[model samples]
Target: MRSSLRPLLVSIVILAAASVGASSARAAASGRPLGNATRATYPSVVSIELLGRSMLYSVNFDQALNENMSAGFGLGSSSMNIHNTDLDANKSATFLPAYFDYYFLNAAGSPYVTAGVTLILNHSSVKGTDTSTGNLEIPSSPVMPTVGGGYEYRSDTGFLFRVAGYLVAGRSLTPWLGFSFGYAF
Candidate 1:
């Protein structure tokens, strides 16, 4: 049983790494069809939230490789200066999220739905009590996966306006409610 399990574990790790490598390559190759393609769509989005003492803002951009696929990256950060009991104890955090999207319908200037997974890395700092009545800072790091869906409005010139909401599951550091605005190019 041990021998069989060893090979299976190795195979699983190799497959996972290969899958990530393949998607990275695809995102790079997606730009290849630019000149001959009918139009390349791109979207840029900005979002803001108000939840008690905590506030957050995020921005992301998407480039449409073809009619059915897209990839995007976003940066976000939040701060809690009020320090309420209900608020998460972390003073601040920053996250970088990347995702690849597949559009169900094929067409320009039409509404389409997308499905994708997001890889997020988070860095946080928490305040703690110090002996001298001063505050001490504790740092934390974590990574998580988020899945979501949204709608896109394509255009003839390859620029688009999109609105999407996704629930991020895993650590509750970031709120489950999130939105994206991007374009397909």
Candidate 2:
């Protein structure tokens, strides 16, 4: 992590945490996306994805602000350590993905487009030995911006699934695919 980006990252994390915490503390809080009073009765969703914007996997949540709009967020993290006769190193990363979607139809199944920013929180350091020491970082920026569209099937019975393709500005501008499964209520 770069020193200059720390404060910005911390501020964002703190503000988001506070906002989410406060919303969830409300009398009727039920994982719904905080929005105007009119949207309070809409259902919210919780899901887990494989190979999505989080890079590997993420636990995701979505709050339906209305029939055609949704607000979403996700959290993902990973750590790796390697040690051998000559090299030892460790790396860790955490990701927070915030996004929004617009469903084309107000039905049980719909096609949607999404746009969001993913905060990449990471650190990698190698223990220095008499022989060598090293430090590494990828996708140098502290954030990744993404846009994509896909089909989502959300049933009245609380079942939800989505298969999405995304263009993510990470490491380089690349295309990524994600599949998700969860429940809405």
Candidate 3:
């Protein structure tokens, strides 16, 4: 009975979120065409995010395939420090991320789920103070898989705002929370 209820609860939650995007009520009150509130008009979105799927920050571009689906890619960079017992170092890395987003509606505001992978290219600009412990192990490249969900607000005039939480999947799961500001032109 408990297991059976899980799916039912999830369905209810999804339906509730989708219902928030319904514009018929707003249309009736404001006297505008409901057709205007859709992804059909604006199919492309460009955004800049902090601590997003890139695991740091990114400038992203996405094209909507339909009302519910989108695909995109991003470029980002990070300056990190590794301070520990064995090694102390600071490095700059570049990240390339690719992802897809599934929106619950085509309205001005909607809920969305996203999945992506990021390729990290580690640059050889390591700065450290403790070299007596023989600091040597360095990773050339690494790829991480990520998934998350969030809400997006897009206006008819092309303004957009988004917030999301992401999980990096691997031997250890790392969680990241991010937000973005962009346009949907």
Q: Which structure among the candidates has the greatest TM-score? A: 3
lDDT of 1 by residue, 130-156 (tens): 101011111222444555555655443
Order of models, best TM-score first: 3, 2, 1
Q: For residues 104-128, could you state the per-residue lDDT of candidate 3 as single tens digits? A: 9878788999998876655345323
The better-scoring model by TM-score among 1 and 3 is 3
Model 2 scores worst on lDDT over the 10 consecutive residues at 127-136
Q: What is the lDDT of residue 171 in candidate 1?
A: 30
**lDDT, each prediction:** 0.41, 0.64, 0.65
Off by over 4 Å in 1: 1-55, 80-84, 87-90, 109-141, 157-159, 172-185
Report, for all candidates in order, the number of backbone clashes. 10, 0, 0
lDDT of 2 by residue, 1-185 (tens): 74643664565455445534443445254544333222224378887766677765689988988778999999975333353233323454577899999989766677899999988755223221111111112355677788999988764344567889998775557677777766666
Candidate 2 vs 3: which has more lDDT? 3
**Candidate number of the best lDDT:** 3
TM-score of each: 0.49, 0.64, 0.68
| Superposition error at 1 for model 3 (Å) | 45
C-alpha RMSD of each candidate structure in angstroms: 16.2, 11.8, 11.4
In terms of TM-score, which candidate is stronger, 1 or 2?
Answer: 2
